[model samples]
Target: MLFDCIPSHEIPELLHCDWLQSCDDEATVLGLLDIFTSLALESSAPDNSRPGVLAALIKHARVLAEYVQRCGPDAVTTRSFIQWILAKTVAELRMEPGFHNVGLDRWDRLVINQGESVHLPVFVPLKPSEKPSWRMFLTTSNTTQESAVKVAYRAALHTDDLSLQAMALKLLSLQLEDPREPLRTLSLLQMGMQGDIDGFLSTSLSRYLLVEHLSDARSLVQELSDLDNLSGGQSLLYSGVNPCLLWARDVILGHLLAVISGQKRAGNREWERNSSLHRFEFQT
Candidate 1:
């Protein structure tokens, strides 16, 4: 049904073609996603376009996202079959122009997880001097106090530069050192964060604490377990920039300290005063 809408030539190449099953390169995948998304939209037009391709591409995209994220690809060759399909989609299709590669952001993450930043080059045409990308290489794997502390300070201890990541990590480590309170660190970090949109804050923090870093991360549990006089807003605000906000060498020293020492939770939403730390409800 998807083929009926396209110019005669475009249909056979895409349909008769097992294009979706054949890609393994990053660029090819982006090219394919863009090409397929376009084809799907075109084919779905009221006049003659096949609506099926739109559904098909969305399906392909999910599969593509999985393949990129969890691929078992061998080194020195195709990383994913998705890459091959992409190459097929692009090489032969009559495609709409100007589709900038949005999928690159998705794939670049895959590259980062594998400790491989090289894949970034294929998606964006980078300058020759761009340093090989790196992320917070860490201390250990579990949530043992030591590991938790490591997770909090993961970025500052590792990478260079005052990237938002460093600001966050530095603040969190300060928390570790000052478990009695986080106000000073919060004050320091607040000054550094310019126009604090949620995306910018979340992304900066996330890039530093990636899923890989968290391991068995239940941050909400941690936060609920140990909040103090400063207000959850202050605690989370500080943590957003760095893990050291409660600088406990482990949960017991830092967290238990907070549990026993935490200021009384006010009758109402006092913590919600700061927009950043107060949004997620504390559903006790």
Candidate 2:
């Protein structure tokens, strides 16, 4: 009840209390969520204070969702509350500055664990001609793809779940065609480095070549080769004469051959020729 006595602006600070953090009773948790929900829906609350209040509501809802899952008999109800809080928060704060920074880790975990059942509000594009994209609401700047890239990378690295990894990689691959150099290159590097290079990594390498990101493609192959050599040629990619390495070698060779035969136009004639020759030497 002490929360009721505090101003809405001060409610967020209550979440940091040591006593609240240690409280495990289900009633107390749910009661706190109820009080926060009321604060969130209070139209009379000052506009300047709303974001902080909603942020606390969201963070606590997420924490309670996890708590209920671990100490159950009420996880289902807790999850429903979390879903409501998330939807409400997005609806209210989608256009607010720094909106992307609040509770992203919590949202990521909820999506990973709950999947599509947790409905994330689609980002409203600034341009009328542009269509809305999921998770685009998290973009930090005019570069629309950055948030999705960061989310996919984090999700890929955070879990060993194969399906989730595949989903993250698939989302990452969608950004490979983005014209922004940094975004596309980040996607390529994340895809290759997140997991076993096996066939997946080769695909990323091939994409880099397709996109004409020659330097990055070459650097990745060299890193893989160096890693293999460092492992005394017993690394997973080299074990049993891995076909992936062979496939990658052939892909790079094919590219170099194309450049040498003038099948691909050289952007810098001398640099392309020298680079092609160096790659041929390394591959062979």
Candidate 3:
């Protein structure tokens, strides 16, 4: 986001020290903070694209991080601005805690959320000189056994579990948009939940969530539908979410799409229909 410009360059006091130091007042300090924040946002918005924008944003973030770490919490005005931007960035990126699993591998990537510089343990080594060490880094994001079971179920579906293909296909038959098909998918899901089929159900959904394999999710949905265990697809539709989850998939999906496309873009200019889903506007 800041391009190749160094933060050392931000030390504007040396040569032109008199310009600002001549009027070293609280107002001047606050004004400098505002400029820095805006410059960060501006420096990071490249071609209005993803990689470009993310890079810029990260650059700006580093600058803010330096200031915050140096001044501590006393820099409330600057800190406040940083916090505001952080929140905006998180919402824009769907980076809410538990919305999706933040991988241990990608943990170090500085993701801005809620104006706080999420001081993650940067995972990837960008330069050869800056290699990441082998000191096993630990994370604390996995949910409870019951929650983990659901996570696994989503995962299996996301990855196309071989054993459940036929079941899923059969289930799909029940959701043919036909007038005669009763809401049986819910029942089948409940059956799986109740019976020893917990492994199948849990792994399937887990796979779907972990890997984002929608086909597997669909197959699982179909599996449930065929067996008449499902009452509706609404729950299946939001498989990775519930009222309890802090963030919704709808918002996360939008954030991901924007991240991929290189902007907070809302619609596909080329494909008009896909454009509708480009916007991640949702009520939590």
Candidate 4:
């Protein structure tokens, strides 16, 4: 295969090849994806090669997704491809040196700063004004983060694979942990409005409490209250007789109260346990 003839270190450059972009054969695309996946797992590759390989996989995954979507939505191949991208991204994040210590903020900044040097165009925005300085690459328009999250969210909603669902949740949780405004809040509200109330509440509340983001938590509570009122209390949580709005509201309010009471609580500890179980060691 042509991929076999290319050195692992130069795999990222293949994305720029005109022929590869023009190729429309699904078998060929899947074959290339499998080869890249295998290469990504080769630990013998120099540490310096990891970032480029990761970026290449992300870029190719986006290309493959667009191609797959043109064929049809929610196909088995689409789910499998999305799963592969998420799994590969998660694996790369795990292997990143000092990923745990540097924190997502620093790591995100590093990616943005080093993006140009590493030829990671995926991190760059199409329009400069679309992303202001305060926003992270993950929330930027048309970047790898947006594409990955969209596909993963779709896969999460459609796939019965428990592990894939977990991966999707983890990816969403990671994004939610970003301290940026508007985008973060918008993502949370979107999840809730889309009927993933459990995910919306658990991910946002747990992450906010874990980091002691009192203001954000309060804002979220207010947002939920307004949403419930706007829906005339017939929101997704409506349980035939009564809406679970009170239950959800109380759950968040209880966390806030616990934080306010000066009593050491278990939310952070529980979040830590769940995070560790998912192998995500991100520190706020």
Candidate 5:
């Protein structure tokens, strides 16, 4: 058995070695991947044991993925392992809120006065058919406070699907726990508004827009409060006019109106051109 070959103490080191080759079979490699995944899940049995064990399991899965890619006996197994790695990584990251610390990139520079002066690498946007798992993996480092921006930028580089990119941008807006970037947030909202993007309101998006669109959000909140008073909380037929959603609609409408009124944003020639009222109406 694979266990007989590796002791518990050596498991950490096993992650760094090409040990999967010892299995000498694709089925065995896949079996080990499954067992490791199960073990990773089992680590969540207790809340206290979660962080360290879960981190280790993610690392282990990554290493196993590498091993399979390099040493798997067949192409099918290698491809399957690659897909599994992507899906498993995404699932774990989504489920384990605490695991946000995983996949963060290390910040190597020091910024005394941070702004646009900071030098950052820019990657080309990916095609719609492409999988951005690797770029997403690279964006996981939290060493810098701008990790959310890094992730958002990666998603922005994706021009293939408006809805998925919008979702990623929404998640980025939510994950930013520090000082907010209104420009970035507004740009994401505008992207979603101008395209075929449609989804429920994101709390982060609603909150940020509420703060920015103070008067609008406030009026909507007051209106909803009035509705609640009138119906005594029995109004289930407002037809999606909840406070959060109303805020999102107001924000999108405000931007769309701005574009229509020929309020051209500086250096946004493409946006101005693409955001014609006809195009906007068609998309809406």
Candidate 6:
């Protein structure tokens, strides 16, 4: 029914092929998602032209979102897939000649909802340099707090640069639990510089403490989170610029002592907490 109004020449064979119907394995599902996302993003029409094409794009995005929601976190590839869908949607919305925004907001909601449904962190792209280091914080399996804390501390100390130190501190904060609230506060201040939106947003602070940061960053964070349109040249959040806003050289001693003390919360609103940190209202 989706293709009924669209011209046959503009449609990809994958849309009509039987291959998608038999999607049973994660690989197949990923392939289909890739195809759908590609079609939605790559094939474009002007705002007033080809209404059916835009409709089809929206439909593909919804289907992909629903399928990814059901995949759960155990599906490793789903993380990247969801991020791609989100990035693609955002890209389309940014284009001046692309389809209208009429139906695209739903796709944004769908991808964000899918991310929340499966406890996947909102997948903001990290810079090339930050990716390997960020991955270091992620364990193949859950590691103990003591170990995680130690790893985070080492990461913090690994670099002398303030931004890098701030990034390490952000990673370290995730490992710290309770009582270390003072350190967390200091770390927040360290990362508070106005220039580093992506680094700040990419951290757990934004995902884990969304409401607090929303209040802290004021409308800036909310606007960044909204992704309505790209008035700026390009988004730091998506364009891959990483700089830690919190963490400094002078406070290593204090951080070490405070770290010896102990660090964490879920927040309100769908956008505000990490889904894993708190059970979403829909889950319970």
Most TM-score-accurate candidate: 4
Off by over 4 Å in 5: 1-57, 64-145, 148-152, 159-164, 174-199, 204-216, 219-284
lDDT of 3 at 230: 42
lDDT of 3 at 261: 44
Q: lDDT tens string, model 3, 93-128? A: 332233233243543221112122221112212111
The order by descending lDDT is 4, 2, 5, 6, 3, 1
User: How far off is residue 199 in model 5, in Å?
Assistant: 4.4
> What root-mean-square deviation over C-alphas does model 2 reach?
17.6
- Model 5 agreement with the true structure over 77-131: per-residue lDDT tens digits: 3333533433243334445445332332232111111112111111111111111
Of the candidates numbered 3 and 6, which has the greater lDDT value?
A: 6
Write candidate 6's Cα lDDT for 1-284 as tens digits.
88778675446444635566665566676676666655544343322244455456556556655666687854423433533433243233334332222433322221122111111123221111111122222212124433433443344344333433343343334333332353344335454543444434333333332222224334433433443232276643245433121111111112222223331111122223233333333210
Off by over 4 Å in 2: 1-166, 179-195, 211-227, 234-245, 257-284
What lDDT would each prediction earn against the true structure?
0.32, 0.41, 0.33, 0.44, 0.38, 0.36
TM per model? 0.21, 0.30, 0.22, 0.35, 0.29, 0.28
- Summarize candidate 1's per-residue lDDT along 1-284 as a digit string, tens digits: 76567765445346424664575576655455555544443343322234344445545654554555453443112322322232222222213222122333422121111111001111111111121221321111222432333333333324322232333333233224222123233323433444322223322232222212232134423432444333445654454532222221122222223333443222222222321333332111
Give the per-residue lDDT digits (tens) of candidate 2, residues 1-284.
76678886565556636547787587676666555544444421322335565566656556655665566654433423433333343334433564443443322111111112111122111111222222332322323444543443454445433433343344343333343343344444444554444433333333432323446445544544444553465644336434423433434444444444545432334334434543422211
Superior candidate under TM-score, 3 versus 5: 5
lDDT (Cα) of model 1: 0.32
Better model by TM-score: candidate 1 vs candidate 6 = 6
Sliding window of 10 residues with minimal summed lDDT for model 2: 109-118
Name the top lDDT candidate: 4
Task: Kindly report which residue stretches of model 1 are placed more than 4 angstroms away from their true locations once superposed.
Answer: 1-30, 33-58, 61-264, 267-269, 276-284
Total backbone collisions, model 2: 0
By lDDT, the better pick of 5 and 6 is 5
C-alpha-based local distance difference test score of model 6: 0.36
